[model samples]
Target chain A: MDLRDPALYAPAGHGDAAVLLALRDPATGALAFPRTPYGIGASGTPAEAAEPVELSGRATLLVCVTVHQPLSPGMQVPLVVARLRLEEGLVIDGVLEGTEEPPPGSAMQAVLVMQGERRACRFRLVGGAA
Target chain B: MSGLASMRPVRVVGIGMHPYQFPSETPYVHLGLTALRGALADAGLAWPDITFAAIGTGAIGMAAGRVMLRHLGSTGLEVVQVENASASGSSAFRTACLMVASGQHEIALALGVDKFGSAQRAANKDGVPRLTPEAEIPAVKFAMMARAWRDRFGLTREDLARVAVKNHGNAARNPYAQFRKPRTLEQVLAANPVAGDLTSLQCTPRGDGAAAAIVASEEAIRRHGLDRRRAVRVLSSVSSSEHQVADEGWSLVEMVQRSGLAALEAAGLGMAEIDIIELHDAFTIEEIVYAEALGLCPLGEGAAQLRAGQWDIGGGRCAVNPSGGLLGMGHPIGPTGIGQVTEIVRQLRGEAEGRHHPGARTALAHMIGLGSVAVGHVLQRD
Candidate 1:
């Protein structure tokens, strides 16, 4: 299956779960998401000194909101966007699985789903964890 | 790192604007020149009197200063273009103030002008791929902020809509505002929903316009015989960018708080001494959140203040965004910040006409740009 953004995540070779690609600063133990080539900004560690790591794709939903209109190009209406705190202590924004806004502090995990012709990463509430 | 106060005093002797309006076929040169001419006329000075010009623009390409100023006849004045996203105008004004205060130039001009739809963001060109590009949209991002505020502070949708109501009403009386019609709470709430609880009326309208401010040293003011009573003294200028915070979502708020406090401290005044504030209100929630961040009220008390009419013009405490702010006055990127200064100067001079806030002797102008930067200035009468 083709992933929407191959640099961000990859299949975990099980169910629908995926592992998030990230970079960790060796000195300060800081984490940066999406694995940019420019290296970690917090510690000023060069890209070569930064170590690649995979996040558990598990997070606690910090906040969520539903976009009622197609504000961006090629955006679908009623999209759910949320800020989540990863278990590794990094915060990131992602698309939620449902149209409804989940209450803050809900448990969520990354899952790969079909978006048009390509598979994309979306966050779903952990079962019985709301 | 001495503040403006530590240097020679700089005062704003003239301010002018070409009313913000919807995108039109009118050339940007016309918009910019109109503002320059107006400022010169208001200052009772000729174009040659301006020894330095700082052009603030977001979309207009290279050498914008020379291209626009050449029509006024070249006098070999120093020209530089400043671009700091929405705070471009504020940055330009700060540059002009510094030049005058440093004695590098006796007279300086800060002019901001821009049109809609042509500006671009550097984040897109950084080559970083995102998992959710839609989250980058400002309205969506701010919607998430509104939701977070609602969850943490129990902010109601009506509480957010009331900001639009007040600013829109203020705009109704402002001749230069893009949104000149007053909107009721119902009208605001019923407006087209753009994101989450944020309606279209709660967002700043995209348009084109221009604003200019002229700053001069006391020596120049006296030599030129400028009216000292009309001059508004610039007490302090402060600029800063976002810092890493525990809550990444509130980084912008942290920047505003730090910059605002620094500005007031540099000016040797407290929040109580500030009778007027013109801040970046591109969205309704910003006015509430930023005001609280700037120490206008404690956290979770902004809505209550708005409810009590404390933030209203002439309603007491301090009038926030008396020029209608970006929500009603329109955000033309570069021009918005200088326009804020123009409004504050007008109010301080008792010349805001229909929208004047009585006894507005001291004012603060705060602006935030795309780089997550904040710029603040404190101005006072006499």
Candidate 2:
């Protein structure tokens, strides 16, 4: 319940990092991001000590209809923010990678995206848009 | 006398609003005072006549209600603060109505005043878990919904743009509107896109404003010899929160549908009886989506009905957002909901001049917030 406590999320070691990275749901077989509610107390245990399940990298991407990205103090541009639907039916918001903006409902595959100090799941188009 | 006859009838005897504008250096006290004074003046009553007040604010924390009271001489009237995201104002109005209906107070005041400056972060304090980055910001979440709507209903970009055009046109006639200039579909389409097909004009601007309404019991109306002809009766008021469903699309629309149904049932009326509506059209697409959800049109037919001018002023059975919705009128969060009540009251009284829907006898004022809560009110000419 103490969400702010740093000890609640601290990983044990490199082996634990893999465990955290491969976190998945046992009930529905969906991949879960570490620190999320399901990933933390999944087994009725503390997040740092919870057992992690392996998950495949595949996912279905729901293409974004529109995007808003503020580049600087006064400038903003259209960006791609897609919804990734994992095989377990868990969907998440993630950034889409490509040179061109894909049409809405285009298929996408899950990938890792780096955001300075953080890394989260992102998606890339499965095939080029028609 | 309809389904509302059973309960002690509460009437909106007065309504007032502070012109919405961009966040300024002006203090909250001044803004609150302006609206409170305006409402008191409109009601033709003094502050002492108000037995209770419910103040609605989303972001102004720490004694938000008392701060406004302190400016008005602190008459020892009971004051309660309400926070329900964008629905804060309507929720506050409902509280005041309940006070009068319960016989706890003869005269009650509901005031919504809010300011969102550059430093403010748009956070929902109601503790709805932010599952993803898109869900954190309102635009992205609504954008996704808009995209899904487009995909499901085959709504074109122009169909969405028309909503902005119509609302802006309605706003132009409203002197109290924040954005009075009418917009064209081409101009709306050319505007900077926010999420999906939503352009800047399609989204409500976060501004600062205050709106106030006075609800009086029938006894108080008779005691003050108030003009009953102009008083708008509160037929029904209902509020509902969103269910934690996995599908975001149904979260908002479904909430509105359920709450609106309850309101209509309480009023002993159906959607067909509604002549005017002031809804929380936070986005252009929301107007279409909510129209369907509220039974203005059959499901998935909001866009087509809109194109047919069913929602336009004087064009169909019901005129939607004749005061220009949040899309065109400017949404100052807490004040927005109370402002809807003001518009509905005015419409029911036939005071909405240029934008008045002919023979407007019944009206609905609705608002929904980020907590995924929806509030609906049915109002009728008294």
Candidate 3:
């Protein structure tokens, strides 16, 4: 299956899980996710000094909300959106796999799921982890 | 950087507004010109008397200033358009203050005007792709914030509704507000849910309006014979953007705190001295969180303050959003921030007849834009 945004994540080489692509500034030890050519903004490190890295897709759910209205074009209603803290300490927002809001501090893992025609990254609660 | 206090003093001599309302067929020119004319009349200054004009707009395209100002008879004054997202008006007002304080201009105009739907976001042009585009919607982002606050601070949904209740009640008395009807907690809760716990009534309505503020130097006020008794002095102006912090969710709040403190420090005042506050309340949750962030109360105590009516117009401690705030007054993009200043000036001058905060002497106007940037200003009467 084709990925919706190949630049943001890729298959983890194990069953349906995915790994988030990120960048690490060599000098400052700072990490940025969804790797961009702009490099780490905080450290002002040039792209040349940044190394490619992959987040394990494991994160702690910080907060989540259910969007009841399709506020944006092509958006479906009652979808769950969440802010997650990656294992590597980077915070990012992503779509949750279920409409139900998982409590903050719940352990979650990223997985690719069909969004219309393309596969997109969605976070799901890790079994027996909190 | 030297604050406004260290420089030559600047005062707001006049303020006017074209009442904010739902999106209509009214031309942006009409909305803008009405405000400009009202301000010129209020300040007792002609078009040529003004040395500079800062046009704050979000939707209207380039050269908005020249096109709009020429209709009032071009005076060949310096004109620059400022666009800083939601804080466009605040930035324009700041520019006008700076110009007068730096001796660049004797008198300047900060005008904010906008229409709905035409504004565009630069985030779409950036190459960054998002995992959840829906989260980019402000309502969704703030709803998540409301959820986080609720979990961390035990904030309830009713607490959020109360913000709407008070602001809508305030708006009912503000002739310039977009939402004029007062809503009860039940009405707000029963309103259409937009995202998370945010109902339609809890969010700022999409609208079109114009607001204008004329700033002048002390020399200009004397030379023009403007009423000094009504002029409110610009005490301080501070602007800053978000910095990376441990909690990404509260990054905006962090910026507000830094800028708010810097503004107070620049003015040589404390929180106890602030009599009124006009803040960005595009969402109900913003007022509560930002008030706490600005030290109106300790963290997790904003709800209690609201319940106690301490933030009301006559609640005793301080009047917040006396002109109805964004939730009720209307956030017409560029005009929202300048409108806040206009409301502050009126309150300080004892001119906000119907919605006046009694004995209001000092006021602060705080606004945040799309870049997650924050701008704050402190103003005082006499």
Q: Model 3 segments beyond 4 Å from truth?
A: B247-249
Candidate 3 structure quality by residue, lDDT tens digits, B229-250 = 9899999999989988874557
All DockQ scores: 0.80, 0.27, 0.79
- Residue B93 accuracy (lDDT) in model 3: 96
Which pairs clash inside model 3? Answer: none
Q: Write the residue-wise lDDT of candidate 1 on A104-124 in tens digits.
A: 889998999999999899998
Q: Please write out the lDDT profile of model 1 over residues B290-354, one tens digit for every residue.
A: 99999999998999999999999999769999999999999998889999999999999999999
Residue B197 error for model 1, in Å?
A: 0.6
Model 2 Cα displacement at B296 (Å)? 0.6
Model 1 alpha-carbon drift over 4 Å, by segment = B247-249
Output DockQ, candidate 3. Answer: 0.79
Supply fnat for every model shown: 0.77, 0.31, 0.81
Report how far residue A50 has shifted in candidate 3, in Å: 1.2
Query: Judged by DockQ cut-offs, is candidate 1 incorrect, acceptable, medium or high?
Result: medium
Give all TM-scores, in the order shown.
Answer: 0.99, 0.87, 0.98
Q: Which residues of candidate 2, in runs, are more than 4 Å off?
A: A1-57, A71-77, A99-107, A114-119, A127-130, B1-6, B118-135, B246-249
The 10 consecutive residues of candidate 2 chain B with the worst lDDT sum are: B124-133
